[model samples]
Target: MSRLTVNKTYKLYIGGKFPRTESGRYYELKGKKGNLLANVSHGSRKDFRNAVVAARKSFRGWWEANAYLRGQILYRIAEILEGRAEQFEDELRAQGSTPAAARKEVLKAIDLFVHYAGWSDKFQALFSSVNPVASPHFNFSVPEPTGVVAAVAPERSGLLGLSSVIAPIIVGGNSGVVLASQSRPLCSVTLAEVINSSDLPGGVVNILTGMRDELLPHLSSHMDVNALLLCSDDPAEQKLVQGEAVENVKRVRLHPDAPLDESPYHILDFQEIKTTWHPVGV
Candidate 1:
């Protein structure tokens, strides 16, 4: 007699809880050798809408959190990732990454989180400006979270790319709805578990695994989403996203390729600069 193994049922991570797609449909994920990797939820427009609602609802709490506290929460996520290093590496391998590459990517993802963690409390200083005005008034500009962001995670590298895109957005106090790597999505859900356990507030980061073609329109056209982050090189697809975004005049940031390094500029991509004027003397 052979022992039975219980396979994992992967679901969409929304508002800090895992739920099957409202469509109740799933697509089989396969490894390099065509072996069944897992069954991933086939997210639909409803799921994306739900995620946007969650992100919007949680925006104020995350935005009001102190910078230092946000930094600490980001660091805590990195710490959790470190503890789950082996599991991530194994999942990467299952997704067809060579053992060496898998290990390297896992480490890179962890370091990326740490890099953004350090930036959480520091980016404002670098980007904000106090103007030298001639009048009896003080003028200054500060960065504020852009609110709900909809992102399509990089399709090439599952864990590393997803981490790179997500870290900057949330660290800057903006909530996000991310469509994970369609083909290799295991690590995205796994990271959601790490986020759920961290001090970060729920609904701050929602992860959905589904086909890009099916979800892009909803993400780009949503009226409530303040911005859009696309990680693709397809001109047609880019054009489509941009065209749809015009409906709400949503800010669109396109990253044709994964960023070379975890730069603070990525955080600014989803930030809105607000200027204020104050009387210098009473």
Candidate 2:
């Protein structure tokens, strides 16, 4: 393949338009052989704050949209993935994955979408249970979106890990800000293109590629972030992030490494439990 002509411009994806990073910072993605794959922008705290605000503002509509509609949108993303499989695979390979493994990762990502799409309607029933309580009232519990979430995808397995982290949250009706994998950032930025082309909402899932250690502290402490999912391989660091989340009492999920076939329960980790009671008699 020929070299990617280094471009002179880039745009931040905020409020659906690709504008330059507010801080006017740009960084390069260096391949294992020290070649440049692409230039990704480093998001400032202000940019991160702006994205969070956008996500929070968009949360109500996304969480309230009919589950079927969300499912349809997710299904459309699957179609888009299929159409862009080669591009995604090329990105995977560009990020140090073997060609064969890149192909597998791309397929795995699509499979994840299909899996979540199937769950869009079914998970509600499975998670919601009619409680047999010791009260004279009809009682039951259901899961609801936890509002805006902040996520750090795994450092390796770029595309696959990204899809895994993203599918579950949005499928459950939550909006999120994702700190893309630092080692393999190109694919995550490219995913923004895929999302813009798919049926996903404007701010449902925002992707930012930057220095993880620098950005994660901000995400962990942000009160607007209702929940946080850290998918790093460093157990100690994961523990520290979980600790920071306790200040705001924000829900925290720590995974050193979740398998490719991780169960639906892990996806439910970022959700909130909501219960309702109604009288059956006057």
Candidate 3:
């Protein structure tokens, strides 16, 4: 008798737990050579809805957490990701990256976390300002997190791209529900595992795997999601999301066309500017 290889079917990461899709549907994942790789959960509208609820529930705590503490949590995630570098490299290789590229991507992903960790407490100061006023009132303007952003991770790069987008979201004190790359879903679930072990609060970041077209409508139309971050070139799809977002007065940011890069502006992309006026005494 011949021994059989057990194929593992990965599930969606929601509210800090891995659960099979409520619809119990899955798509066949193929490797670079066109062989069957694994079964990735085909997440449904219900799953996206549940993720938003979880994100909303955890918002205030993450929002109010001191910046230093948030930076530490992000650093901890980098630690875990660094320890599992070889595993991420393997996943990247299977998903069509060359050995050298795989190694570089793994390193980049780790560095991305650390880079954003350093910025966690600093961006606010660089971006916030006090304005001179002619009146007796002093004016101050600051950027603050927009709660519950739902994003479609870029389709081209897997772990590197996913990390590029996610690090800034949580570091800025915003909770997120992100849909992973449809073509390369393996590393995302693995990242969820790393996040789970890194002392991040449950629901602070949610990752789901599914068809982008299938999930975009729900992510856009949901009333509870405060912002939408999308990476798509299709004009029709972009129009659809923009139209739907108007119903809830949601912020819609179409991700830039360039490859994933680290910048403090990316973090500010998810933030809203708040202005305050205070009376001054002579």
Give all candidates' CA lDDT scores.
0.93, 0.81, 0.91
Candidate 2 — what's its lDDT? 0.81
lDDT of 1 by residue, 1-282 (tens): 899998888999999899999999999998887889999999999999999999999999999999999999999999999999999999999998999999999999999999999998899999999999989999999999999999999898889999998999999999999999998899999999999999788899999999999999999999999999999989988999999999889999999756336899999999999999999987
Q: For candidate 2, give the lDDT of residue 221.
A: 88
User: TM-scores of the models, in the given order?
Assistant: 0.98, 0.93, 0.96
Best by lDDT: 1
Please rank every candidate by lDDT, starting with the best: 1, 3, 2
* Candidate with more favorable, higher TM-score: 1 or 3: 1
Query: Which candidate do you rate higher for TM-score, 1 or 2?
Result: 1
Candidate 3 clashes between residue pairs 3 or more apart in a chain or in different chains = none
Q: For candidate 1, which ten residues in a row score worst on lDDT?
A: 253-262
What TM-score should be assigned to candidate 2?
Answer: 0.93
Model 3 stretches astray by more than 4 angstroms: 1-7, 257-259
lDDT of model 2 at residue 118?
A: 79
